[model samples]
Target: MTLILWTALGYLLGSIPFGVAITRVLGLGDLRQIGSGNIGATNVLRTGNKPAAFATLLLDSGKGAIAVLLARHFGGETAAMLAGGAAFLGHCFPVWLGFRGGKGVATFLGTLIALHWPLGLIACGVWLLSAVISRISSLSALLAAALSPVFAWAIGRADLVLVSLFMAVLIFARHRANIARLLDGSEPRIGRGKP
Candidate 1:
């Protein structure tokens, strides 16, 4: 019962799509119509609203961090990780949004930060470097997710290895369409840069 409650709480928290909500509240219409139809920060940027995009990014990460923190406070250490994972899953497949949700990268990063501050900072660095080099947000997100588990394990967070690795997989999976576009050399680059 407790586990179910944790998962439900986590999912409910994650289902709150900040990008879509913010856009709607601000009379921006359906965010899905503007960009890649994703409710993530990258898509929000496609709207050319830098401030909104930035807010979406921060809020998305905050959702995951808050879930983990709440779990740690009310449940336990393992529960924190579990709730974080549940939040990622929710972001990937939100029930309130027809099971079509944002990619899990932002949420995963937040989860990492909640678990280990240094690892989170390193992951963000890697992500920024990848984005600058490839100019593809998807690629950057993938690389960051891929490296997160390594950093977590290397830092003696063996208990978090499996969870973080699982998170990596989930984030990677959420980028399936981007992966296809990347392979076809048609993926859109980050910001207004070249593809």
Candidate 2:
């Protein structure tokens, strides 16, 4: 019951579409109508509002971090992991968005930071390196997500490895279209706007 409650709370909190709300507030109109139709920072960047995209990224990540932190504080590591997983799920399939939401990369990173800062930092490094090398946002995200489980295990966070793997799987699933585009060398690079 405690796990269920914490996970529910996490989902509810995570489901808040900061990207959509921020763009709307900024008078950018419905965020879903533009770009890839995704309510994520990358999609928001298509509006050519760097500040808005940055804000959306921070808030999206923050919500996941907050969910994990609260669950850990009240329920301990196991609950924290559960909450983090649920939070990631919420971001990927937000109810308010008719089960369509972001790709979960930002939320995954946020959960990693809350679960284990060292692992989070390592993941960020991987993301940055990949982004710099490939200039492809989806590729960078995929590489980082793929490496998180290994980092968690290396850091003696066995409990988090499964969660990391689960998040990685979801991230990959969400990027299926991007994966196809990548294979065809037709995917849009970061800062090039939507593909």
Candidate RMSDs in order: 1.6, 0.9
Q: Flag regions of model 1 displaced more than 4 Å.
A: 193-195
lDDT (tens digit, per residue) of candidate 1 on 90-150 = 8888888999999988888898898777888889999999998889899999999998889
Q: Best candidate per TM-score, number? A: 2
Backbone clash tally (model 1): 0
Most accurate candidate by lDDT:
2
What's the C-alpha lDDT at position 39 in model 2? 90
Model 2: lDDT of residue 193:
68
Candidate 2 has a TM-score of 0.97
